[model samples]
Target: MNKSTLALAVAVGVLAQQAGAAGFIEDSKASVSSRTMYFNNDNRDGGADQKETAEGLKFDYLSGFTQGTVGFGIDAQALVGIHLDGGKGHHPYPSSFFPSDSDGSAASEWSRASANVKARFSKTEAHLGGALQPNMPILVANDSRLLPQTFEGGTISSKEIDNVTFNVGQLEHAAGRASSNSTGLAVAGGTEESNQFRYAGADWKVTKDLTLQYYHANLKDYYKQDFLGLVHVWPIGTNQSFKTDLRYFDSSSDGKNGDAGYQFNNNGGFAKTPGEVDNKTWSAMFTYTLGGNAFLLGHQRVNDDGGFVYLNQGSVVNDNRRSEEAGGASFYLFTDSMINGFVRAGENTTFGQYSYDFAALGVPGLKASAAYLYGDNIKAKNGTSPDQSEWERDLRVDYTIQQGVLKGFGTTLRHGTYRGSDTGIASQDQTRLIFNYTYSFL
Candidate 1:
């Protein structure tokens, strides 16, 4: 173990020995969770077919703050991934589903552990060490595979003022879902290591149904970004309501991004200078909800300068052997569809979804939804000026035990199909079946 990991373990051990220290032991909680997943992908244009199955075991432990003006606590997680079935057909080929060996085969098993040390004072808190996962409009951790991505960072959050919250953080490294080691941050076309990522943001609740947000972030040598968002809800009656959401982002290249080894691929999309980061994006979404039914529609547009850019480890092919260690990441965007993100440069996308809950018809624990998205006016490379286009459709269903011994057992099914013009990605279909259950001990 490294210094950070060892220090976290020692801190937790010392804190656990002081079990009689008021809130520390009284509010402690533990849980064990399990997941079984089967994944299948069919490439319509004669690409490789993928089929695989995996099982995951996860354990969590959380301790409440001790009784004091400035209290201390700890949180720890253990994750284990077991490859149940993956034949030659399931080889790792440009995906993060499983760890890839020297021969491109999936590993039989992999595991990792993480911990966090936290301190609290009044309505504000500070956390340090690894296992940091932040869920904000600017950055989201991926949890779609056997394990969730984690970051090595420190963050501070304050809610001391009513209806206002503030957050700031600095991240040094990231560990992918399938790897055990941490690596420096980089984008999709750059292999240069950048260890500094700083961000600050705040949310203001101006009214009972309206909220506004702003955030600024810098990935040291890659790019800088700013985001603004607004949300409002209007009650239409006793059982109906309408919600509106608007978001905007502006991004530009940073220091090393103009140099060698620090170029961006733009996700294979069009770029004014081939490898520069220069873009602006905006989106609007509205939804109406009545009882157990919901209808949502949205539109998004990407400026003509370049494609949208976010943190991507797949571009780290020339790094310190950290390619597989930094694979999955998520960003907040309406067009982040199931199979494709649909954020190519100069692209305009329209999307909608309809969903229903079976509980409205006296059957609890079941829900279903379908969504579709279409993108047009996508810019092409080589200055061709031809407007390329693409589309995707997705369906999802979920059920959970309502009132039995397995009250929290859950099952989910999802399917998606993607097709595009000759200048875009090839056609494909994907499906996933997932089973999940959790047990708590206190």
Candidate 2:
């Protein structure tokens, strides 16, 4: 068995011995969540369209720490995905949404389970397991599909100091949102697994209205990246406020990064050194909120040397198989929209969004948002073509039952349209409708 599996077994054994412990049984929590999604992607540029529907069920159990100086507990998760509908031609081969069977068609169902051993001491906590979902500035687990992605690794988070939080982790493998198997970490176009992704970061709340962050990460044999961020909020009145968020990243190649087996695709964009990673990106966003309405504006710039880089295992083929359809990822960026990420080399993008909550209009659980992004001056491959440009527009609406028997039931609808000029990226329109519900058991 793998190290994570063995660790889980040992932790479960310990839990069995301490099943009736005071705090462990008294403060435990359990929940089950269900999601049903209908996804439709229309390729405007002659590619085959993808239309599919699926249902995902997730069960989670979080045990409270045992009563002691150094307490121990466990977190377990089980997920199952059922393919409800997708015709032969609609279910694309090598899809990022569902696993394929022997005939290259969507599989009927798939399932996976994982557990984490956790310990708490004073004001710090540590977790070791295969069901880790981290949401730090350096990494964000993807959950835009029927199921959420997960990582296999160990993480330590501490808030021992007042108004300061520290985080460190080392991730070895990833299970994609639509996948059942785990694969080692790698970048785009990289076929060889790296197996080591280490990161350290800290968030400091300098004041009640201001916060600062810094983080550094390295994927062995791939790339190293550093991020710095600042956020501040100013309250103008009882129901008025303005916020500013600024972020910067510097990334460069690591050992064997430009080698044949460890190439970076630069998100299908132009790269100055071909397969090497060398990038500097920055973004700034401002938001103004008045009552229940909010407006946001942002600008992002990518250096002329290369496109941004992040950990992705989509292209890695493990053991002559494609890692059980392990594909799709998310990056921490304002432009990581529904259809496209305007992160090409030498690209400068400006974006804006408007959102409103219906509670101010007498509706308790309704919200809607509209966003638009325009990018220009994208470097072309080999400098042979004219500079490229792209634009995208997105619309989303969500509602939830605020009361009654299905109080927690929610529904969301999203649509996006993307177009590019002289860029290799595809022009497309995409839409998704999702239904979500959760039940808690203590």
Top lDDT hit: 2
lDDT of 1 by residue, 6-73 (tens): 66677777677765788887898999999998988888999788899999898998888898898888
User: Which stretches in model 1 have alpha-carbon errors above 4 Å?
Assistant: 1-20, 317-322
Model 2: lowest-lDDT 10 consecutive positions: 321-330
Provide backbone clash counts, one per model: 0, 0
Candidates' C-alpha lDDT:
0.85, 0.92
RMSD value for candidate 2: 1.1
Q: Give candidate 2's whole-model lDDT.
A: 0.92
Error at 183, model 2, angstroms: 0.4
Score every model by TM-score. 0.95, 0.98
| Candidate 2 lDDT by residue in tens digits, 75-149 | 999999999998668988887788888888899999999889999999999999999999987898889999999
Error of 1 at 342 (Å): 0.8
